[model samples]
Target: MRHDHHGRTHRLELDDQSLRTWDSTVLASDPEDGLVLDRSAFYPGGGGQPPDQGVLLWGGVQTRIVGVRPRDDLWLVPDPDDPLPPVGTQVRGAVDDDRRSLLMRTHSGLHVLRGVMARDFGVPVTGGNMEPGQARLDFDLAEVPAGFKESLTEKLNAEVAADRAIQVRVLPRAQAYALGPIVKTATDLLPPDLEDIRLVDVVGLDLQADGGTHVASTKQIGRIEVAKVENKGRGFRRIRLKLVD
Candidate 1:
């Protein structure tokens, strides 16, 4: 969502099994400006999921990619004082694997909670975001009584225990719009010129149009600890959760 969809590279997360490292070539580079690659594995920040960081190795040297911005094009910005790979240079990009794994689990945990809320309580998730190991989701329901969150937490862990497989696919815009995903925030924001939609399905559980990276299964999300519940007013409520052990 940060850059024009066309300017972004083929998302590495879509491959499901290809998140470890990426090999690419420098498409554009400026010592005082930033770097652009022919293709990149970094997930440009969007959908409440922060961008990924790692190192780019070239000519026996490593440049830490501190962050990325989508000004005009997807720019792979390196940390100041770090060497920048020049245009036409061959580079190997490595994402912070541990951080990425934790984020994937946290993101998937939020999706699981959303699915259970809809399936059992008929409540829809409104919005939320995630940090490294924790996440939160908002719901349209209000004035929930005693033991409501306790029961919800129980159901959330049940999904993880089930170890259901996670599936990802790119559907045509028309067909994707027809599924009526439980969450529509991301899909609804896609630029009109976007031809295909990315869908993440938690097997027999939940499905939504999501652009963020996620684990391959519910079991990979680990156990979720309900940290707090809040009344956001106007019939909005929030559940904060974290991945544990």
Candidate 2:
């Protein structure tokens, strides 16, 4: 049996390699120059990160694959009419630069917030989602402090202004296990191939096992404001934010 390996597999070398030059299978019916590959590192909008919006250039027509989906071992781009490249044909894929950049910053900013909550308020993330211009991260906190909204807003923006480097990598299971555990309660949520888990580390700040794209530095995130904070449950609070001047 042929082992099908494609979907959601974090490329450990993405940090070093150009994300645009991935060698992929032509999972389409009709061959084209710009066709979406079967397996892509592009996080199909999930867990809050909006689906990536990008163009697929083939022949002379530039087709946009503005959506992404994770299916077993395949990154499914649902474009019915758009012809698919042959099974073995190679193609060049490029992300929507502007949109992607915003997402990168937003994702990194969320991580900073997650780290801050963990260190200062003793909270762990419960859920989160990042849109184009705004983001919301949910945390497990017993009480929503009265002054924390303003203070957290200030603290997070300060970190972004400090311009800390955002690091990303794929670690072997053993190495990943060696790091201090930050994922609490849902250890079972880990995929069986723990060795292939991607780790997103913010130098001197935070470390998380994530597969989403991110900015290289926090400075690019610009000034962020905590727009609101609300109670979601007995011990859960959600923080909402957006970019500001």
Best by TM-score: 1
Those runs of model 1 whose alpha carbons end farther than 4 Å from true positions after fitting are 1-8, 31-33, 185-187
Segments of candidate 2 deviating more than 4 angstroms: 1-13, 16-25, 30-41, 78-90, 184-188
> For candidate 1, lDDT tens digit of each residue in 187-225?
356678867778889988888878788888899999898
Residue-wise lDDT of candidate 2 within 1-245, one digit each (tens)?
12123443443224542264354445543322233365454556644678666655555654457576555543546355665555565555566767777777888889889878877877667777778768998887887767989999989988898899988776676777689873532234776755466678888888877767788888988889999998888987889988774
TM-score versus the correct structure, for each prediction:
0.91, 0.82
Q: With candidate 2 superimposed using the best TM-score fit, by how many Å does residue 111's alpha carbon deviate from the native?
A: 0.4
What lDDT does each candidate get?
0.80, 0.68
Report each candidate's C-alpha RMSD, comma-separated, in the order given: 2.7, 4.0
Model 1 poorest 10 in a row by lDDT: 1-10
